[model samples]
Each structure stands twice: as C-alpha cells, then as structure tokens.
Target: MKIGLIGSGDVGQALAHGFTSEGHDVKIGTRSPRENLVSYSDASSFGEIVVIATPWSGTKAAIDAAVAGNFKDKTVIDVTNPLVMRENGPPELALGHTDSGGEQVQRWLPGAHVIKAFNIVGNAFMYKPEFPHGPPTMFIAGNEGDAKVAVTRILTSFGWETIDIGGIEGARLLEPMCILWVLTGVRSGNWNQAFRMLRK
Candidate 1:
C-alpha cells in the first residue's frame, strides 16, 4: 500500500515510519513542492490511502492544498486535535464541546471516507506500542463501516487492539481523549501511557 501523509510532524513521522516498517510505501507531504511531491501526487492520483496529520488549526488548509477531490473514494485517517493552550495553562479545545476536529475534516473533504483514529492516543504509543500486559486498546470511529474495518486492521498491525466507537459523530468523544492523554502526561510526566478499554 502506498501511503501519503500530509504532515511531517511527530504524529505523521511516527505513523509514516510505522507503515514504512510494515512494508508500505510512504510519502510525507509538505507545503513546499519538493523532492517528495512529484511522487506523492502520483500516489494520490493512483488513489493511495492518505493520512491527515496536520495540526487542528491547519487541517482545513492542508486538506484544501492537498486537493481533497483527489482523495475522493479514498480512506483518510484523521489524527488531528483542536486544542490550543494558553501560556503555561491547560489546553482548551478550539472547537466547541459538541463539535470535533475529525467531523470538521470530514465536512471539508466531503467525498473522502474520514475515519477518526490515532487521535485518542499519544504519538509516543502510536507505533509498535509495548505495554506490561497485552496490546493497548485504540478507539476508532467513522461513518463508513468498511473504512473503519480497514483502519482496525492497520491499528492491529501497529500493535493496538481497536475498538470501533460507531460513526463520525463519535468523534465528539474520541477527539477529547487527547486532552485526557495530555493532562496525564503533564501531571505525571508519563508520555508513554495509553488507555485500554476493559471489560469483564
């Protein structure tokens, strides 16, 4: 599988490395047209799976610049969160409590199948996560059932147990999981911790 990543930040880099290590062709997209864009555009033209890893603020522009129409009929993994922090304070979600970044991305790219995954967990534990017990659970949601299944397979390949939390509307719950994750990191200085869904 050829994967096109729209951001080169930590989350994007981690996922790109993970997929590349799993024998997928990976292209990291940037704002500047450079060494990778030619091949990246070719992959996009050929209908490769694209992952949007840009910051919440830049998500729309990134999708717009990447040509969302090119991603039509393609599965897009949305891993962005809309949290803006004040100086030395806790982060505030830019989108209202009812809305989420994933839904916004979905709205922007109306034709693309947008699945919300990897937003719930910290990037440190995103690829090849190792826990004291078994694989950590990852929560995913999207309107397209098939796309969610594909994303679940990818999550399993990356060493996570995936839990499908229903449609894109579930993103309202999943996106803020990042806030809990970051708060834990700040309070305890543990960046590697991940949430696991437990059942009796």
Candidate 2:
C-alpha cells in the first residue's frame, strides 16, 4: 500500500518508518518538501491510504492543502487530537468534551472515510511494539466498517492489538485519551506508557 503522511514531526516520522519497514511505500509530506521527503503532490498521487499526522492546530489546513477533490472512496486515518499546548504547561483538548479532533477532521473532509487510530498510543510504541507482556491494544473508531478493517490490519502488522470502538462518535471519548496519555507522561516523567484494553 502507498501511504501518504501529512506531517513530518515525531508522530509522522515514527509511523512512516513503521510502515516503510513493513514493505509499504511511504511518503512523508511537509509544507516544505526537502530532497529526501516528498511534497503533498507526491503523496496525493501515490496514495492508497492517507494518514493525517499533523498537530491539532494545523489539521484542517494540512488536509485542505494536501489533497484535492473529494477523498470519498479513500480511507483517511486521523491520528490527531485537538490538544492546545501552552508554552508554560502541558496540552489540553481544544474542542472540549462535546466534539473531538477526529470528528472535526471528518467534517472538513466530508467525503473521506475518516478513522481514528494511534491517538491513544505514544509515538515510542507506534512501530513494531514490544511490551513487557503482549501486544497492547490500539483503539480505533470510524463509520466505515471496511476502512476500519484495513486500518486494523495495518496496525496489527505493526504489532498492535486493535479494538474497534464503534463509529466516529466514539472519537468524542477517544480524543480525551490524549489528555490522559500526556498527563501520565508529565506526572510520572515517562512518555512510554500506552493504554491497553483488556477484557476481563
């Protein structure tokens, strides 16, 4: 699969490497595409799947600038959270409890199949994950069943145990998980911990 990544930051780089290592054609898109990196055009042309890994603030613009026309039949994985980061302290969710970044992305790209994944896991664990025990759960939610399945397979290839948390509305809850992830990182001074869904 040809994967188009919209950001070149930590999350983008991590997922790019993970996918490329799995033998998938990966293109990392940036506002300023360098020699090694590809432009948004390169991404759009090579896309089988497009992953929006940009910061919460630039999510809409990135999508608008990256893809042309309606991404109606394409699966666009939204890995962003509406976290408003302050210079003095940690990040907070900007959209509040009612709406989420994933939903907002879906709203902007109305025709695209938006799936929320990788928002709960830290960047450190995004690749071929090796926990103390077994594979950690990756929570995913989307309105499209087929899109979710494709995302699940990709995530599982990267060694994640996927959990389908219903439809896009589930993002209302999933986006807050970023706050929990960051809070745990700040409180314990460890950003390596990831949430795992266990059925008891």
Best by TM-score: 2
Model 1 agreement with the true structure over 1-200: per-residue lDDT tens digits: 87888887899889988998899988887776567543334435544788888887787777777886789988989898887867986787888568788888889989989999998787878999999989999888889988888899899999999998888888889877888888888999878789897899
Worst-scoring 10-residue span by lDDT in model 1: 38-47
Q: Candidates' lDDT values, in order?
A: 0.83, 0.85
True-structure lDDT of candidate 1: 0.83
**Could you tell me the TM-score of candidate 1?**
0.93
**lDDT at position 97, candidate 2:** 66
**Candidate 1 local lDDT, residue 185:** 86
TM-score per prediction, in order, is: 0.93, 0.95
